[model samples]
Structures are given as structure tokens and as C-alpha cells.
Target chain A: DAGVTQSPTHLIKTRGQQVTLRCSPISGHKSVSWYQQVLGQGPQFIFQYYEKEERGRGNFPDRFSARQFPNYSSELNVNALLLGDSALYLCASSLRHRGETQYFGPGTRLLVL
Target chain B: DQQVKQNSPSLSVQEGRISILNCDYTNSMFDYFLWYKKYPAEGPTFLISISSIKDKNEDGRFTVFLNKSAKHLSLHIVPSQPGDSAVYFCAAPDTSGTYKYIFGTGTRLKVLA
Candidate 1:
């Protein structure tokens, strides 16, 4: 089966601009999560959606938000981007089963200039 | 605050030797732990996982040990190969049912042949 897929493998945005990144979950996965990884650092949780509902949120600022579609595809939006927002935005999908593992997508690398 | 930490930013080991990567977590509420491996320009892939109920979980050449009392965990790869050169991240899930993951800063491993 195909793994999770993300769009716009790379993106360039300027400060004060808004950016949107997309992700499609594996064919049969239901739970999807988003993460941001800065250079030389681990990924930080952004948001999680299950059954197209916002299930959880991280410590992100109000400018960061996300939503999942009925098809289990997700989009991450960042408003008023700052240079520090430059990072790799990763999407991960997992089954709801106990002890289930989350599989990741290739990610969309956003560079804010 | 960084709840998870991997103090060693990088490690070098000879091929065919054992490679040990350490992780320490500060939150006692985290019950599920996972390890992921990542290469440049790609997203992280699940390597293995160990629940708080278990002390160790093994899969092929990969083994993860969890010490709840010490709030520490480590990943061991036996007979490390050049192909194993990559970054490893340690992650923990929220026990409050959010399923949010907190990740370590990651450790880059280089296997020399």
C-alpha cells in the first residue's frame, strides 16, 4: 500500500505571508497528526485530527491551525509567518488500534525568507 | 521546557559493532514510547516501540529498553551497518488521550565501515 503523501515537497514563503501545506493519509488510516521540525531539532507536535475532528493541539501559537477532510486528508495553515517558521512540516497517520504505530509522509519543507 | 532529551548530538561507531542511543524523559505521565529513524530529505519512519508496562521490546536487530523508575529509555542496534547511518528520534505519547507526541532533539549516528 502507498504510504502517507504530502504536497508541495518544497515551498518558499516570505515573512507576514500565509502558507498552507497538505497531507493525504494512507488509504485505510483514520488518525492524522502534524508536526514541525526545525533544522537540527526534533519535530514538535502541531495538531492532530481524528474522524475529521480536532482531537488535540500542541503549544503552537494562534497563527497555526489545521483541519482534516472527510477523505482523511489534512491541511496545515500558518498565518503571518515569521522567519522562524521555516521548517519541515510532516504529516503522520495511524490506526486507532491500541499500541498502533504512526506512519509519516515525506513532508513539505517550507522556507520563510 | 524540553520534556525529552538526547544529550548526544552525534555518535560514531564501527560497522558490525553495537550502537546504543540513549533518551531521557522527564514526564512520568508518558506511557507509550516510540523510536523513529530518519534520513535527509525524508520523514521519520517507525523503528520500534515499548510500552510503559514492558521493560523491553525486541524486533530483529532492534531492541528498545524502558526503565520507568529512571524515566529513561534506550535503543540498541546490533551489528550496525553503514546503512544505519541516520538520525534517531525518541518520542512519547500523552497519557491524557490526546495522542500527542513529544520528541527528542534526535541523535545522528554514523556507522563507519
Candidate 2:
């Protein structure tokens, strides 16, 4: 009954550093997706995983990567973080990878300085 | 180029009045559309969605109307409440077999009490 959950509610990292954010999908959910939302902007798609496989990826650079686990949890890794990378990292889950309503978590706020 | 756009950056409406938020998309291949509501320092929450085949979908006081011809969609909230004040985003899945979503810039709504 609990919705999707994410860890490190807020994070601060220096430029060129590496960071990993985690997400646990809702109970019975099989798909997990990542998104980034900058200040005063809407969320942008990052990556989507279904059944522990990469189903989709956004226009982010190679520095950004993600993986889904057997338990349907997901981790978003960002290497060589820049000031531009500072944003709210959101994790969403759906019943499947296809067209379905995605439920989101509280999101991890990353501030790169 | 931004595939989805919300021209109005903000909207103010009195409580108990009708609140309307508009969105326009350039991708014709997008078949599914959705709306999300977000508060400060939180992730977006699913609002209402409408498929390309349907012109409208309603949930309680929320209604979404899709116009395929104009590639435009609108969310209508009847008897808007102060609790409804938040940022609204419109989104559609990528048509490139990615299942990733393209979201609008978002419109911030303020419901005056």
C-alpha cells in the first residue's frame, strides 16, 4: 500500500564528484523510471526499467546511468556531476513499462556546488 | 525544441471558480497524455489522463480534454480549492519505442481563498 520510496531526501555534492540515488518501487509494481526537475521547470525523463531490463533512456549524457534490481528497486548513478546537474531526482513506478499511470516518490534533491 | 509547452507560466483563480490549464504538444505520434500536480520540494503526483482515442476523461472534480487536431490538451478543475494550488504539468510518452515521457514546462496555479 505504500507508494514509491526514494532515499537521501536531500544531497549535496561537489562538482566532478559521483553520486548514487536509490528508489524502491511500490508493492506489486514492476516498472521504475527516473526523472530530473530543475528549478521552475517540469520533470524530464531520465531512464525507465521494466523487469530488470532497460526499457527506455532519456537524452541525458553517458555520465548518467541506472539499473534495476530483481526486487524492482532502482539506482540512478551520476558521475562527474556538474552545477547543471543540480536538480530534483524523482523516481516513479508503474504496473508495467508500457503506457500506464506512473506513481512518484518524494524525490531526492541533489545540489551540486 | 520543446515538444511540449505550457505557455502560461502561472494562473490565479478564486476559490470555487473554474481553473483551466492548457498544454500544447508538437509530436503527433504521442497517443497517451497525462497530467501531474506538484508542490514545492515534492515529486509530481498523477492527476488525470486521456488517451488519443478519447476526447475527455474525468475524475471527480478534475477533467482532461484532448484535441488531437490541434495537438492541444487542457485540464479543468471545477470549484477550485485553495488546496489545489500547485504546479501542473502535462506529459506524453515518447513515440520512439522508449516509453519515456516528454513533459511541459508546467503552469503554476494559485487558488485564492
Candidate 3:
């Protein structure tokens, strides 16, 4: 089966702009999570959605938000983007909300100027 | 405070040798730990995982050793191949009882032929 898939493999945005990234979980997966990875750093949690409900959120600012659809796809939106927002946005899916292994997508690389 | 830490920024090992990567965590609430491997432009892939109840778990050529008393874990790759050269990250579920995961800074391993 195909693994987790993400859209718009790359993007370029300007400061104060808004961007949206998309992700589709593996078939039969119900939980989706988002993470941001800055250069030279590990992936940091952003948001997690299980059964289409917000199950957890990271320390990111209000400018970052995400939502999951009934089909278990997810979208990550960043408003008023800043240069600091430039990074790789990764999406992961798991069988359930807790204690399960998460499979990741190729990620969308965003650059903010 | 950083909950997970991978002290070594990079490592270089000769092919057919053993490559060891270390990680440390400050949170005792993490009941399980996982390792991920990432290529340059791809998302991290689930590697190996071990529960706190066990001290070691081994895969084909990869072994994960956990030391609960030390709040530490290590990933060992035997007969390291050039394909194994990539960034390795150690992660654990958040202590907040959520699905979020905390990841280390990652250690880049380069296996030379």
C-alpha cells in the first residue's frame, strides 16, 4: 500500500503571506499529525488530530493551525508567515491516537522570504 | 527545557564497521522510545522502537538499546552500509498524555565505503 502522501512538495512564500500544505494518511489510518523541521534540527510536533478531532497541539503560535477531514486527510495552514517559518512541514499517520507507530510523508519544504 | 537530546551533530564510520548513535531524555514519563531515519528530501521513516519494559530490541542490522536508569538510548547499526548514512532521530511520546511526540536534535551518520 502507498504510504502517507503530502502535496506541493515545495513552496515559496513572503512575509505576511499565508500558505497551506496538505497531507493524506495511509489507507486505514485514522490519526494524522503535523510537525515542523528546521535545518539541522529534528521534527517538532505541531498538531495532532485523531478521528477528526484535535487531540493535541504543540507550542507553535496562533499563526499555525491544522484540521483533519473525515477521510483522514489533513491540512496545515500558516498565516502571516515569517522568515522563521521556513522549514519542512511533515505529516505523519498512525493507526490510533496513542502508543502506535507513526508513518511519515515526504514533507513540504516551505521557504518564507 | 529540551526533553530529548542527540549530542553528536555528526558521525563518520567506515563501511562494514559498527555505527553507534546516542540520545538522552529528561522526561521519565516517556514509556516508549522510537528511532527514525531521514534522507535529504524525504520525511523520516519509522525505524525501530522499544518499550520501557524492555532494555533492548533488535532488527535485521539495527539494534536499539534503552537504559531507563540513565534516561538514555542508543541505535547501533552493524556492518554499516553507505545507504545507512542519514540523519537519525530519537523520539518519544509527550508526557502530557497526548499523541504528540518529542524528538531529539538528530545525529547525522555518514558511512564511508
Candidate 4:
């Protein structure tokens, strides 16, 4: 089976613009989560959705939001982008909401000028 | 605050030697820990995991050791190979119901042939 997949592998946005990244969980997976990875740094948790319900959120600001669809796909939305938002946005999926191994996607690279 | 930390920014090891990467976490609430490997332009892939109930877990050439008293964890790759060279991340799940992961800053490992 294919691993988790993400869309628009690369994106460019202005400081005040908004961007949306999409992710499709591996088949049969029920939980999806979002993370932001800055250069030379590990990924930071953003949000997690399980069974299409908001199950977890990270320390990110209100401008970052996400949702999961019935099919277990997810979308991460960032508003009023800042230069600091220029990083790889990764999406992960797992079989359950807790204590399960998560597989990740190639990630969406967002650059804000 | 950085609850999880990989103080080593990078590591270089001979191909036939063992590669050891360390991580320290501050949150006592974290009960599960995981390791992930990532290549350039790709998302992280699961390496190994250990629960609070266990002190050590091994898979193939990889081994992870957990020291609950010191809040420290380390990944060991025996007979390291060039393919094993990549950024390694250590993560732990939220104690609450979020099911989210807190990640370390990552250590870039370079295995020399």
C-alpha cells in the first residue's frame, strides 16, 4: 500500500497571504496529524484528527487550523503567513489516536516572502 | 520550552561502527517514545518505539534504550551504513487525550563509507 501522501509539494506565498496543504492518509488508517518542520529542526505538532473529529492541537497560534474528512484525509490551513512559516509541513497518519506508530508524507514546502 | 532535545546537531561515524544518537525529554507525563528517520525532501519514517514499561527495545540492527530516571533516550545502530545517514528525530506523545507528539530538534547523522 502507498504511504501517506501530501499535495502541492511546493508552495510560495506572501507575508500576508494564506495557504492550504492537503494530506491523504494511508489506506485503512483512521487518524491524521499535522506538523511543521523548520530547517535544522524536528517537526512541531500542529493538529491531530481522529475519526473526523478534532482530537488534539499543538502549541501553534490560532492562525493555524486543520480538519479531517470522512475519508481520513486532512488539510492544514495557515493564515497571515509569516517568514517563519517557511518550512516543510508534514502530515502523519496512524491506525488509532493513541500510542500507535505514525507514518508521514513527503510534506508541503511553504515559503513566505 | 523544548521538552525534547537532541543536543548533538550532527554526528559522523565509520560505516562499520556503531552510531549512537541521544535525546532528553523533560515532561514526566510523556509515556511513549519513538524514533524516526528522514531523508532530504521526504517525510520522516518510523524507526522504533518503546513504552514507559520497557527499558529497551531492539529491531534488526537498531536498538533504543530508555532511562526513565534521567528522562533520557538513545538510538543505537549497529554496523552503521551510508544509507542510515539522515536526520533522526525523537518524539513522545501527549499525556492528555491529544495523542499528539512532541519532537526533538533532530540530529543529522552522516555515516561514512
Candidate 5:
């Protein structure tokens, strides 16, 4: 089975622009989560969706939002991007357990100038 | 403040030697802990995990240990190989009922052959 898949392997944006990153979970996965990894740092949780609902959210600001589709795919959107927003955006999928191991995707590299 | 921390930035070991990476957390409510490995351009892959109920969980050559009293965890790779070189992160579930995770900065392990 294919693992978690993300689209637009790389992206570039300017300050004040918006970007959207997409992810499709594994064949039988029901939960999807988003994370951001800056260079030299660990991935930080952003949002999580399960069964087409917002199940969890991280410490990100209102500018960041995400939603799950009925088919279990997810999209993470960042508005008014800043230079500081440049990072690798990772999407992870797992079973619907409240807390469990997550399988991650290749991730989208976003660079904001 | 960083709730999860990996003080060691990098480590190098000869192939076939043992590789030990450490992590520490300040949150007492963290009941679940996990370790993940990441290659240069890929996302993190779950390596091993241990719940608060267990002190150690092993799989193949990877082992994870958790200490609730010290709020610490560590991952051990026995007979480390060059293929085992990667960035390792330690993470824990948040207690805010969001199913989110806080991650350590990560430790880069280089197994020299």
C-alpha cells in the first residue's frame, strides 16, 4: 500500500502570499495531521483531522488552518505568509486512536521570500 | 519554553557500535512517548514508542525507554549501521485533549563505516 502522499513537493511564495499544501493518507488511514519542521528543528504539530472533523489543533496562530475531506485527504493553508513561514510542511496519517504512532509523508518544502 | 528537549545536537559512532540518543520532557501529564527517524529530505518515520505503563519497548535493533519520574526517554540502536544514521526526534502527546505532540529539537546520528 502506498504511504502518506503529499502534493507539490516544493513551493515558493512571497511575503503576504498564501499557500496550500495537500496530503492524501494511506489506503486505510482515517486520521491526518499536519506538522512544520524548520531547519535544524523537530517537526511541530499544526492540526489534526479525523472523520472530516477538526479533532485537534496545535499552537499555531489563526493564520494557519486545515480541513479534511470526506475521503480522508487533508489540506493545510497558511495565509499572509512571512519569511519565517518557510519550512518543510509534513502530513502524517494514522489510525483513529487518540494517541498513536504517525506515519509521515515526504512533506512539501515551502520557501517564502 | 521547550517542553521536550534533546540536548545533544549530533553524535558519531563507528559502525557496529551502540548509538544512544537522549530526550527529556518537563510535562508530567505526558502519558505517551515516541521516537522517530528522519532522512535528509524525507519526513519522519516512527521508530519505536513506549507508553507510561512500560519502561521499554524493543523492535529489532531499535529500543525506546521511558522514565516517568525523570520525564525522560531515550532511544538505543544496537550494532548501529551506516543506514541507521539519521535525525532522531523524541515526542510526547499533549495533555490538553487535542491529541497533539510536542517534539524535541532532534539529534543527528552519524554511523561511520
Candidate 6:
């Protein structure tokens, strides 16, 4: 089966602009989560949605938000982007909300000027 | 605070030798840990995972060892291959019982032929 898939493999935005990245979970998966990875650092949790509900959120600012659809797809939106927001945004899916392995997508690389 | 940490920024090993990557976590409440491998421009792929109840878990040429008292974990790849060269990250679930994960800074491993 196809793994988790993300859209707009690459993006470029300016400071104060807004951007949206999309992700589709694996078939039969109900949980989706978003993460951000800067150069030389590991992925940082951003938001997690299970069955279309916000299950958890990370320490990111209000500029970052995400939501899951009934089909288990998710979108990550960043408003008023800053240069510090430039990074790879990753999406992962799991079969359940807890104690399950999460499969990841190729991620969308975003650059903010 | 960085709940998960991989102090070693990189490692080099000869092919057929063993590659060991270490990780340390601050929260004792974290009972499950996972290892992931990532190539440039791609999302992380799950490698292995271990529960706090177990000290060691092995799969194929990969092994994960957990030390609860030390709050440390390590991933061992026996007879490392060149394809194993990549950034490896160790992660643990959020302490808040959400599906979110806390990932380490990652250790880049290069297996030379």
C-alpha cells in the first residue's frame, strides 16, 4: 500500500505571507500528526489529530494550525511566516492514537524569505 | 527542554562493522522509544522501537537497547551497509499521553565502503 503522502513537495514564501501544506494518511489510518524539522535538528511535534479531532498540540506559536478531515487527510497552515519558519514540514500517520508506530511522508520543504 | 537528545552529531563506520547511535531522554515517564532513519529530502522511516518493560529488542541486523536507569537508548546495526548511511533519530511519545512524539537532534551515520 502507498505510504503517507504530502503535497507541494517544495514551497517558497515571504515574511508575513501564509502557506498551507497538505498530507494524506495511509489507507485505513485514522491518526495524523504534523512536525517541523529545521536543519541539523530532529522533527518537532506541531499538532496531532485523531479521527478528525485535535488530540494534541506542540509549543508552536498561534501562527501554526492544523486540522484533519474525515478521510484522515490533514493540512498545516502557517500565517505571518517568518524566516525562522523555513523548514521541512512532515506528516505522519498511525493506526491509532496511542502506542502505535507512525509512518511518515516525504515532507514539504518550505523556505521563507 | 529537549526531552530527547542525541549528543553525537555524526558517526563514521566501515562497512561490515557495527554502528552504534546513542540517545538520552529526560523524562522517566516515557515508556516507549523509537528509532527512525531518514535520507536527504525524505521523511523519517521507522527503524525499531522498544518498550521500557524490555531491555533489548532486535530485528534483522538492527538492535535497540534501553537502559531505564540511565535514561539512555542505543541503536546497533551489525555489519552495517553503505545504504545505512543516513541521519538516525530517536523519539519518544509525549508525556501528556498524546500521540505526539518528541524527537532527538539526530545522529548522522556514514557507513563507508
DockQ of each: 0.67, 0.81, 0.88, 0.86, 0.79, 0.88
Clashing pairs in 2: none
Query: How large is the C-alpha RMSD of every model relative to the true structure?
Result: 1.3, 0.9, 0.7, 1.1, 1.2, 0.8
Off by over 4 Å in 4: none
For B1-113, candidate 5 gives per-residue lDDT tens digits of 89999999999999999999999999888888989899988999888889899999999999888888888888999989999999999988788787777899999999999
Please identify model 6 stretches exceeding 4 Å from their true place.
Answer: none
Worst 10 residues of 5 chain B by lDDT: B93-102
Per residue, candidate 3 scores C-alpha lDDT tens digits across A54-92 of: 999988999999999989999999999999999999999
Q: Give per-residue CA lDDT, model 2, range A1-113, as digits (tens).
A: 89999999999999999999999999999999999999877788999999999998888999999999999999999999999999999999999998778999999999999
TM-score of 3: 0.98
User: Candidate 3 lDDT, tens digit per residue, B1-113?
Assistant: 89999999999999999999999999998999999999999999999999999999999999999999999999999989999999999999886868788899999999999
How do the residues A14-96 of candidate 5 rate in per-residue lDDT, one tens digit apiece? Answer: 99999999999998889999999999888888999999999888888999999999899999999999999999999999888
Clashing pairs for model 3 are none
- TM-score of the A-chain for all models: 0.96, 0.98, 0.99, 0.98, 0.97, 0.99
Worst 10 residues of 6 chain B by lDDT: B93-102
What residue runs in model 5 are displaced by over 4 Å at the alpha carbon? none
Worst 10 residues of 5 chain A by lDDT: A94-103
Q: Residue B105 of candidate 5: its Cα lDDT?
A: 98
Task: Indicate which candidate wins on DockQ.
Answer: 3
Cα lDDT tens digits for candidate 6, A1-113: 99999999999999999999999999999999999999999999899999899999888999999999888999999999999999999999999988789999999999999
Interface RMSD of each: 1.8, 0.9, 0.8, 0.9, 1.3, 0.9
On the 0 to 100 scale, the lDDT of residue A59 in model 4 is: 84
